[model samples]
Target chain A: MSERYLFRGNHAIAEGAMRAGCRFFAGYPITPQNEIPEYFSARMPDYGGVFLQTESEIAAINMLFGASAAGVRAMTTSSSPGISLMQEGISYSCGADLPMVIANVVRGGPGLGNIAPAQSDYFQATRGGGHGDYRTPVLAPNSVQEMFEFPKLAFELAERYRTPVIILADGLLGQMIEPLEYTFDPVDPKTLPKKDYILDGCKGRERRVIRSYDLRPGYLEKLNFERIKKYQKIEAEEVRYETDHLDDAEFVIIAYGTCSRVAKAAVRLARNNGVKMGLLRPITLWPFPKKMIEELTGKTRLFIVVEMSMGQMIEDVELVVKGKAPVRLIPHPGGGIPTAREIWERFQQFREEL
Target chain B: MRKVYHRPEGLTDTLMRYCPGCGHGIIHRIIAELLVELNIRERTVGIAPVGCSVFADEYFNCDMIQPAHGRGPAVATGLKRANPDLIVFSYQGDGDLAAIGTAEIVHAAARNENFTVIFVNNAIYGMTGGQLAPTTLPNMVSTTTPRGRNTKLAGNPIRVCELLNSLDGPVYINRTSVHTPQWVLKTKKAIKRGFEIQMAKKGFALIEVLSMCPTNWRMSPIESSRWIEEVMSKYYELKLFRDLTKEEK
Candidate 1:
């Protein structure tokens, strides 16, 4: 049995990145995620990795761009406001087809809104947060174990797709501590397959160039079309979700991240009270489990979308459901977490009305 | 018969899109020649900034990355720190290095990042048309400053070498021009020295090249070169502000 150790979500993320062979990390300090950079600063040197406390979040993301272009697994962590500052670099990484990982420990936001846990950035993560036409694959981790294990998966998806990957978490998850075990042995970067497109040097080969712009007319359009096909491929292959009693579930609660954990408890409460409620937790928020939701729509009478914000993920749920069933939202905007008892009571009320 | 002149292997065959008599071509040629002369062509990784030299990734015959506007220094720091064996340089324009990316450049210098920076100060935003630049000379006429730059309104031109020379992290900081043939040779020498310092793992080194922008300045090629020597050089003095090698010697 793997030995279990108590770890905070933020520190686990840093440790998981190091174990995943991330040799470069640059990030600015922000609330709920300060421990990430602090942990990396103290531990990375021992692992022969580089850690940089950058001037701003913009510099951190741009640094990731450079490190990723040089064929190194790199990561950066920031909060809501800081993540907003990093959009430009993230868009550039997408345009240039460079691979990198970014973790956004969400806090209440609209502008320095507060350091309380919130899921207001769901729309920004699923849709391309930055300008231009692109989508960054997003992974929503709810548990401390998922926080520790997601960085390795995020890096794999980033390199496999040659695009930026976002690990979307909230302050509640980042601050929570739990016992966790390593899911796999630490990776040795030297043993990894060599990437052909890295810009380490042009020795014994033709020189390579990595750029986002195509000045020639119609060239950028062509590139965009090719990238869209890659997105489609990912949608087909990378959709991931967890189902709880979904087979016989007449009512479903759809949620993710911290809210999903609450919804899971609410589902258990409803089941104990002789209600046929189920929970569907989405892991990959970008290649969202659209097929599973559509399949569930046939058997489900109603869907309750519980979120820490004002109904952001509900839009995706509604789109997938296609108005076949009614969807209701239990929104607690601005750092409010819905209690399991409250959710169960609301479901009972809605059922009584039905 | 011996050939006296040939194209340097450091540059690609892609034709530069710069306007005629533009200083970018001249500066590009100098960097290419130095890359070959130093024999670090294969191991060098150049960063192209978003300005007139945005296409530098195509021109520089080495592994290159074109990052976002004004982010060259941060990118270079990452590349150099991640792999110490790789030779990295960031080629930037005035708007990129001084105006928008000031923090990146200053912090990189403060860290004494072991890399080379080629800052081209043409006194105008060449790529975005004739707008004002951070290094624009006082009372100089630009599109934004049509009636000439007012020192009180627009602020004074930044003396980049002098500003950076005050920092202890930088091992070498020099300002050179590429207008006259003598100054062009001197600019090449200063840039070469900057790369040499990086090769020796000394510290951060910057070579500020006061270049010509004939199209943006709306002047003839000869007049543009003459303007750089007579007018621009007065505000930005052509001299070495800091040289650790010379200090030690």
Candidate 2:
């Protein structure tokens, strides 16, 4: 394992996927994340992996569907608008019960908004960006190290659940450079679970058919119920978050990804000024750390929700809070990261109100 | 007991849900028979499109995938790239391949991906109850074109074989039909050849089968076959459009 190497967040994700036994990569070029495909385009061949700069985001995700269906580790990376184009394929993958990784290096958008980092896609990511009764484990990575680590983590979760997993990152995290250490050896594909469902030519066995179209009266209901059970299991086992200085704290600021990193700095400054602020960062946003937040409802008097969107995650926070405590939103809108000083000012306002 | 005929091992015992006298049943049998003959059933993957053949996976005894409408080629590309030893093919209807999946099929051919495509051109959106398709002939009436297809507004039928021939990626590209016993045998042979090319690890291979849609065409099965020969085949002629392997020889 190397101690350190200069890597962009996107490149770290690409390297992590390759080491995680991703044998196929297909993606379309989109901003702040273009380096991911470019890295794979150069490195995959050296490892005997397949890399395709697909014609469109739709094609890329479909390629992932095909590769994953064939019982190989596969992935694709895109930003907000590109991810929207892939929802159909994403839903299809979930229905087909294929395991794969997808990274949304999110940028601002309701449409083709600027390529700057923004958390506006939190709703789209955590709420099944694709259609149907399915949920993808969404992992939010704040540091370049987590960016390197989450892809591998995403693959394991995807394989364990036989479902897709999403690495919900934003542009600033994607474009930023950091020193990363390779702490793991590359995964050996041969050691992966036997995919009896893979389409590997049915010569020595009964033919395996992987499909999602169950048109019978109660067939879909049965399948959807099974999917719900799987989601329930994931919810029970995969809730992840980090707490900072929460012991004896009166005010807590909740955020994730790049915004959480900013909130951490703001909390530090607020604590220096005796404002008693702590930071709670959600690492897995899909199976959100609801219990942790619910625990704070009575213990903490005020909870601050900071984000790069118009109060998207605040809804989830409120659901967990259950009106036990007052909550305020500090929105940074889209296209830019919120400053720590701005967050500290908000903490001051909340402290004065208290 | 000298068995003169029986179902191939590549097919399940389950009866298909296709309409009576549909060409899909015949085509399905052809593919199944060939998979057994080639002994590639276990290592073969088929991508099903979102048309009537979306249920093709139900009939095939091999591993199968049903992708979104018109995205079979892209899915096939991924499968083939992931495991070069696997025999991959996509089964697509006219609307699925020509209308919505144009980019996927075109780029797949352009990439020279080593796989086969079973393109079924029924000239109407069969599964959707006879809507006009990209291959619908001029003056042909469909639900969407109640007054007959107006070439001025709807454009002429696209000749998929000729269109793909313009690309150098495909190692083999052919068009055949299942209207008559003679054409049915020919289409089967073309399909077999397409599979052989795929087994050889040659580039993309496509076999377009001009099929009959009796229910969608508002005619008996017999009339539908006649219509295919007289109308559809006239515009989409049966022939081998390209064979790059031949050029290499």
Candidate 3:
């Protein structure tokens, strides 16, 4: 049975993780995401789950490494600076092939940027932020309802690919209140595929070793090739995006996360003003919906990339567009969301240049 | 004639990878021997630190994980918390635990995380070509400390067991060495006791061994063994710092 309830985005994410059978959660207190661990602390103990407030972000992520290796669903949450502290562990999880979920309630930052909503972490989340030639599947949630839904999907993708998955939510989505419908079924650990490589003891089985270090010649290369193969599989099968008024539109806007919601409103306004504008919201940022951009380049007159950063994802959009269509970027520096009126204004300015 | 001596069931047939006369092989043997004797060989999960002992998973005939540098305890905490019935331990070297990993070990102890930690303090970084470690004694020369280490400049050696003894989280804390046959037996007893405390679900337990690094110490095996007894043991000491089970009794 499904139920609907009022929830803040952070609370919806917490509930969504619990529904996805996260039995262990460890985190440190950070703004915009403190409510995540705070909610788990009150709720996990009642269900015999472990909720730990670690000393630092480093400790929390390492705890996730341990819990996941023990063959249980484990997770951690942090904002920007905290996520920076977690880079080494994140890289380690990738190297060791541990399945875990991380939620970054992104605040503005190059370093201690601000405790406001921002999509500045787009590059850090999409690209491997740590020292590795690897990529984690990044899910960007544009709505409070998506905040409730992406956790389950993140865990599934993580386990399916044997890699870490990130739910990239900005502060606006995390702080805003909305009605969320529970659509996912609570998963049972027993029903999940047996993790034969976990470090849960060697009883009645061959001793298992989970390590990333390979000093031998050509050994690490082989391991990296395997990782690349898995990533290719993910990129092939897991590209997700939402397209609105794309067909027969003269102007198109590419955005994700909070900016997507704003772009949708701007598209509506542009249509009312006799401008043929469409919006494409990428839900899976890493396995980016590049195919859609390729298909739309010939149909649209101009592609406008909207983001709350100094133009990160625009590079990716342009790479796919391949100069078939002229591309322009409307940048919003961190710490606040651009209003629909502001986005509509940008559309008008770009149309004038056209 | 009966076969009087045989390799323990907890060790694989893989040849030892430690440098000649390194203390890691002996320590590995002791852990395997204890695991077999305690009958927890199968239900034991060991986390290998990213140091000289990073390949420890290859030697142990049980489930093992090689965590990133200084992340052994954090990994062990997660493993033990998730699987309460399993016996979990982490094998770490001095640089791996006492230096970059100081925050992790200290907080793990403060939390009273129920697990065992086998800390091998050799006082110098061996795997990365003999750099000065946090446990490196004053005036000790390494690749990094070209001249003798200056306490005023490089900070004094960290007595890990003493530092951790200040924390109230751990149930058993002891420092032992394996310089001689007698000391080997005592170190083994300490390792076994750590596992016993974890089995009792007391709290965190640690057995810090003052191991040897002959190649990096620029000495012969026997000379390094003497150095540990004469120099390392003088400062680190060979004594139990805390024992909650003894207090209860």
- Candidate with top lDDT is 1
Model 3: DockQ vs. true structure:
0.88
Predicted candidate 1 versus true structure: per-residue lDDT over A285-311, tens digit per residue: 999999999999998998999999998
For candidate 2, write residues B1-249 as lDDT tens digits.
899998888888988889887899899999999998988888888888888998898888888888899999999998888888999989999999998999999999999999999999999998889999999989999998999999998888888889998997889999999989998899889989999999998879999998888888888999988888787788898898888888889
Q: Which stretches of candidate 1 lie over 4 Å from their true place?
A: none
iRMS values in order, in angstroms?
0.6, 1.0, 0.8
True contacts kept of each: 0.81, 0.91, 0.90
Candidate 2 clash pair list: A200-B42, A200-B43, A201-B42, A201-B43, A201-B44, A202-B41, A202-B42, A202-B43, A203-B42
Chain B TM, per prediction: 0.98, 0.97, 0.98
List the RMSD of every prediction in angstroms: 1.0, 1.4, 1.2
Clashes of 1: 0
Selected candidate, larger lDDT, 1 vs 2: 1
Q: Name the runs in model 2 displaced over 4 angstroms.
A: B1-3
lDDT of 3 at A322: 88
lDDT of 3 at A37: 91
Candidate 1 structure quality by residue, lDDT tens digits, B127-199: 9998999998888889999999998999988878888887889999999988988988998999999999999
Q: Across residues A1-354, which tens digit of lDDT does each residue of candidate 3 receive?
A: 467789999988988888888899999999988889999998887657899998889988999998998888899999999999999999989998988999999998889999998888888989988998899999999888998888889988998988999999989899999988878677766688777788778887899988877889999999999999999999999999998888878899999999999999999999999889999999999999989899998888999999988899999998999888899998887787887898888778887898
